[model samples]
Target: MALQIFETDPDARPAPKVKSEYTRPAFTFRSGMQRNRKPVKLDNWRIVAEELEPLKALAELLGGTAEEYSASAREPFHVLTETDSVEIVIDGAGAVEERMILWGPNGPIHECDGVEFLSPADAKGKPCGCPKELDQRKAWAQQGRGPKPNIPIRFRLAGLGYELGFGLLRISAWTFLPDLDPLKAALAAIDGEALCTLELEHISFINDKGEKIEYSKPKITVQGAYADAIAEER
Candidate 1:
């Protein structure tokens, strides 16, 4: 025997489209965060680095075209600062460079190009002395000995920070640190050469001063050899 599933009329009228305030509201819960700031766009932008070696490793890992080899190229927007779990499509790489990170009595102060760092005279300006850790790491790397874990890696990265943007996009290239777990995993997991997404997570390093300190150093969490997944919550 056949069963009759519907009780209502077959030709019932459809519900009218109702526009909710949330659909395109003037004010939203996030209005406080945005503060009604108008968005901006750019028609053309470019980024050029004197060197390209620094970006080679990550670029190759992300995979790129021959054009990406150019020392300079047009792009959309430069990264102003690290974001929370930002989505990016890796385009090309920039020169490899080292950075001298200074942690003063206050906290993390500034990071200067490693090449530009000449001598102790530079430290004369900063509160902290020449980092003994850097010297030790350098010596260990030369002799091929000592605990060489968690050495800092620096390079420039060029890519689409997000998929959606206006024609007038913000184009820029910025330095990248592979100090986070997701980035480290993304690099390691590449099967020879491949394109993939990198989900970055923000991390903080506590400055364990014997006396109480007010501030702390922020870092990207580093996890597996090849991190394809977003970082797990701590």
Candidate 2:
């Protein structure tokens, strides 16, 4: 017989409850004596300078650490040039031998696309000609070997458009990111006016086979002098 909705019967018995296999299990906390507890990673941190505690007397050798949350990042981020390039030649002993700024095949150094050396009438320097192109630079290459600055480390200039008047821009690589003492020396060398940043960049160059090879190195620049507080500190 079909049961009607909401019908009550005196002979009816209560239905038995069935347990579900998909029921969620209860959580249990482990005791401190448990051997399989997960390890804690970087639970806490402290900020300290070399002048404090274990770092005492090591201030010259060690640096300081600042909390990212508590400290504010510096301002006036510097911008490097994408086209003009510079190069630092490191000796086998990891010391810098030479630093030069390079102008590509298409640069201000050349009046035309053809390669040649700079004429004496072009500038007020010595009688020796400045190479206007890669081919022209072969003789000036170290020991008359090959073109100078075969590989370049490109960077941008800072300040108002002052560098536009120059054909070639170059400086010593040491002019960048020095140790504390050296940094102070560099500031003094530049009359406390240079504001710069160093960056690691991956750049592509064409090999003899015309295949592109990529390499990474540090790039230096002073493009953010206006907004950088360090410039003002100088």
Candidate 3:
């Protein structure tokens, strides 16, 4: 006899789509000096020289190439702040040449391009610095280091900061020390310096084969603290 399968008489219903709220918002970063109201919103945006070089090493750890080359490609769009968490680069400028990040909040949300996200627990346990790891990863590169990571990636003046890449690479959810002035200002302004909570929204953009051009919409959500800071700084 053929194997028989029985189904409990039940109706199938379409599931409603539940969208996520954690998205990287878009807003301009202005120089604190010119504004004159509060400190500059960009005032909080400063580069953390030492922390960034290693951010690359960490990216390679997630996924890049074991051997280093003069390849100046990472992710299409990345937003990196000084490891101190002060300055931030949103789309592209330094090592990045071609711009690919999408603008506007609620624009689009695409999976990262060969990107991986780790839990907070996993991130905090990593070793400090990337000298050895960077040397090892960058050793085989023939193209040469793109441009030693720069401080203050790029402040958009009236818009958000952007740091675009050539490949798919990013670091999310890592905490910074108190010495980071930008974070200090944003935090104190947002939470009244009571040791409150801060959320660093991380986003990834992936274009696996450049095939999904139509669906490759990017999404942003820079409201609340991010928006408030921008307003006050201006």
Candidate 4:
């Protein structure tokens, strides 16, 4: 065999298209603060981003406050907005999925459809063995043997316009599962094009042991068709 050498000009090749660095933001209903070497929780919807303009816009629209914080060395800083509720536009019924997920420290360890395992390759299609009754499922979850709801609803901030990008609200609490069926039905009826409100409803009560209990639950309210919403704005 004979060896051959070839010369090429790097600049002769066309430049590749610049890839976008855009990522869909998240709408979180709770945040944790470090206190006494532990995390204290706060109930409020939070919008976080690497940039400030978008967070400011969201804070202004949702009647919240935007603030900057030191996240870490790699990303140095981040902007966040905390609010009680925000309006959004759901594109269609396909924007949401109701599933259950058991996550490990790194990622999902198992996923299910309430009755059967759906992931981890080998576990797919196997019986999940979750209790058919809701209460029993809750008990199972409490014992760390069952998955929790992991419904993710994708939507765009109602008045912010899509140029800023979409937002995702992932509902993981098992208590919120019951309330989702009606919302899912409504989204389906409207073909998923609807103006919706995402809010955290505070709940407080005393248990049988006389201990005060307080928490917040995420709620979704469909305002109307997306077209009508835009028309009214116009």
Query: lDDT scores for all predictions?
Result: 0.30, 0.30, 0.27, 0.72
**Model 3 lDDT per residue over 27-110, tens place:** 211122222345333312221111234334333333332232223433122223332122222332231111111112454221
Q: In terms of TM-score, how similar is model 3 to the real structure?
A: 0.19
Best candidate per TM-score, number? Answer: 4
How many clashes in each structure? 22, 2, 30, 0
lDDT of 1 by residue, 1-234 (tens): 754434356456456788852221110000001113653222111222223332233234334311232223322112122222222222212111234544445643544343333235655344332335666645643464422222233211224222212111110112133333445455455433223322332224546665543321223333332223322322
- Tell me model 1's lDDT, rounded to 2 decimals: 0.30
When 3 and 4 are scored with lDDT, the better candidate is 4
Residue 86, model 4: Cα distance from true site in angstroms: 1.9
TM-score of each: 0.23, 0.25, 0.19, 0.77
lDDT of 1 at 57: 30
User: Evaluated with lDDT, which candidate comes out highest?
Assistant: 4
What is the TM-score of candidate 4? 0.77
Runs off by more than 4 Å, candidate 2: 1-125, 129-131, 138-192, 205-212, 223-234
Give stretches of model 4 more than 4 Å off.
1-23, 26-43, 50-53, 63-82
